[model samples]
Target chain A: MDRQAILVELKKVLAPYIKNKELLDGITENTNLITDLKINSANLVDIVIDAEAQYNIEIDADSAENMVTIQNCIDVIEEKLSSANS
Target chain B: MHSAGNDVVAFRLTDPERSAQPRFYNQILSPSEIALFHSGALPSLSFHIFLWLCWSIKESAYKFRKRYHPDLVFSPTAIPVTEIRATAQQITHEGPQNASTDPQITGTDHQITHPVLQITGTDHQITHPVLLITNAAHQITHPVHVITGRTEDLFFRSELFPEGIHTVVYRHPDFKSVRSGYAFLQQALGSNHPQTNGATEPTPETQSAAVRELVLLDLRKRDPNGAWSFGKHKEGYPLLYRNGVLQPVPLSLAHHDQLLGFSYLLPVS
Candidate 1:
């Protein structure tokens, strides 16, 4: 899947966890999960798990740690999806 | 508790804004932890506590590791929580006749009873991943033994404020450990130092300094000869010592809204 397509699914996974709805609406590839959406550090796990189930991909420890931004999430999902397809 | 090689963490659970964010978990937890959350094995409240529990364990483990490897950097994913068992604290409330019993009470003038959280747990087997620092690296897959202790409570004067979770981890299971010195930030800053700007809502750094001082002051009473100097060791872990001698006694520090605390193992004689 492409970045835009992955972002759509990402938004769905993030909606419930984001405290700032305005930030969520304006979220882009550059948006940071902690600074922009003000997501609590604890809920980040839920997003990772949800993203895996939503996109049907697994995120490793290193990738999970680097998944601080929306773009990072998209990159990991895309990579995982492609690798699985290959 | 005996303090030889133990540490504790006190975190504020009052911030609804932070608690709502989903990205926060990524910064602190490992992959297996996320799976545990998905497993739905623990209750909602227990799960929430479990999150903090994991955080405390990592934090405590970091403190423990810092003593041996000062350059060790803390990455929650790098440290895995192996086992945890719920433990109970037997608290006996013996105080003044009416309300004002606990001296650590803040935010209100009226006397109130402090509710000690029932469910607290301890974990002994927490593993630290191989670390690679600036020009210095160490790899150890061996799981380090750490004893973790936790407490959760919601302090209130009128309205119920957010719950605070306090946790301690000891390098040696037999070592005694404790976390104390709860103070209001506003009151502590004003009385401790006669500075001009007594900002009610100080930054996290400011709050941490004030709280660290209060905790250190309380710690000093136990060992009058032990002059604790603060500095960063190998991987920027905070170091403390009594007198001029370098002490291996592990110490952990934390500060959050309206609270700051320290946990350490008392040096074994």
Candidate 2:
């Protein structure tokens, strides 16, 4: 899947937990998942679960630790998606 | 340094090398953590709630005694330097008789009664200092204190240490199905359940739920209706759990909240 497509899906996963967080409106590829968007880590949990469902992959503890930044999360998702296809 | 939106209150705590710096340091709290408190996701405790406790008696020690909101110390990152028993004897033999002659310290020598943590004091090096948490609710049930309401004492002390290892007197009767770190702690501490051990086993979902319930219980006044409430409680602040009893988790597998970053202690050794 393309980067844009994955980011769009990411937004949907983040929607529920980030209430009134205008940062969501400005979310972009460069956006930092926690710092920029103001999305709580708890919400990030929901995002990961959502990510697994959309891409049909599993995120383990060690690998998940790398998803600190938005770009990092996207990279992980892309990696997962690509692997699934191969 | 300012990555996304984390209101990074930069502190020098993480680096052991700078542990000797005379300057006081600060650190940034994570985003989800910001949501936990500021969002009113958690409640705040009022002085009135602690009216009957010991800190209430030592009015002078309260920094601002007559004031409505008395000042309380919130020291986090207190290092767990093995068991205090071994360390205490060593210190006693080496130190002077007036171990707590710091004239600034007041009241019934809280320094002695409390447990000592080998934390990086303001001076910065990882050194031993006694933790004198005077919260009325914590440890009230310990046999010595003879305080009532087992659950109340247990819940407050639960704030300091995660649970397990050190046994506190009061045991809060927690309602089931609660979600939060505090809830998990209560269950973990109370749990002698065959399969689980505090630091050994990863905190199960059941334990997290227990922690959440306990957090709500500690800040009960703010969360009158329980879980559904969505806003900051009294202090209108989402202060980071000072010691970070939980933290720096792999944001991948766990929910930000569920990640349980280097949070409160569960006794590793």
Candidate 3:
């Protein structure tokens, strides 16, 4: 799957948790989940769990710890997908 | 450098929807802790309290370790909350002995009891100095002095409110007595800022933002040096800096739901 496709899926997964509509509208690869979107830290757990189920990928604790940004999530998703394919 | 770390969890924030989610719990807790959590022994404690207890311990240990390991990326599973044992009886006796020597400390030293948590990790076994504040309704009946090992009997007092559960790691107990305080502000709702220090100034737009601002202000109120900077390692845990140099003093701030606060164990002369 292409990176853009993963981004699309990520947006869908993150839609329910986005607290700030303005941030959701303007979110980019650089948009920080916590700093920009104002998502509570506790909700991050739900997002990670949801992402795993959506993408059919497993995220180790190290990767999950750094998933502070949209780009970080996309990168991890893409990497996980690539590794799964291989 | 000596430091402390803390985390708070408001009971109202406990999401019933996510409570049944197994994957969510797995990510934050160790297998052993998970079992212990489900065990019948801790019937009085809720899952939210149990989770935050471990989280606070990890956070405290992380804050202490981050000083030396700034490059480290903290994984909660990397360090588990191995044990949280009460030291009230032991510390209560020690409190009066030291209180007699120090003129500044007041009241019955017995009132400051704080629990100590054992943290086990892949490469380290660390004892984190911790204080657990339960809701006023569910308050631990035994009130003990918050004594650090270094200060021996000097009690560092943390006022427990009736709201949520609070866990604080006072990493630097001996350098000086820990100055720990917290405040609950009216939720800023549409505006995002909560009234800080009961000041009339415009509050920050978000509770997290407001809590951080309040913590910085509280730290300055206690520290002789008003000038301070927050330095973070490559990852994002904060490093306390003062006078344009890294200070050994470790400071930690936490906010949950409607509450925000800070803790610092000041360096001794």
Candidate 1 lDDT over B1-269, as tens digits, reads 22211222223332334433455565566567767666754322344445665665565555555555544444666776543432222333432112122224211122323432233222211111100010111111213432222221111011011234434444333222333334445445654443314433445456658766765666565657667777656543466766766776555565545544455544545
Please write out the lDDT profile of model 3 over residues B225-246, one tens digit for every residue: 6677777555555567777888
Residue A59 miss distance in model 2 (angstroms): 1.4
Best by lDDT: 3
lDDT of every model, 2 decimals: 0.50, 0.31, 0.54
lDDT of 2 by residue, B2-106 (tens): 000000000121232322221211111222322332343212211111111111111111111112222322111111111011122222211111222211111
What DockQ does each listed candidate score? 0.10, 0.05, 0.48
Q: What is the C-alpha RMSD of each candidate to the true structure, in Å?
A: 12.2, 20.0, 10.9
Candidate closest to the true structure, highest TM-score: 3
Tell me the spans in candidate 1 whose CA falls farther than 4 Å from its real position: A1-60, A66-86, B1-44, B70-78, B88-91, B94-162, B177-200, B225-228, B241-248
Q: lDDT (0-100) at residue B85 of candidate 2?
A: 16
Better of 1 and 2 by TM-score: 1
> Candidate 2 A-chain TM?
0.85
On the 0 to 100 scale, the lDDT of residue B37 in model 1 is 61
* Estimated TM-score for each candidate: 0.50, 0.30, 0.64
What TM-score does chain A of model 3 get? Answer: 0.92
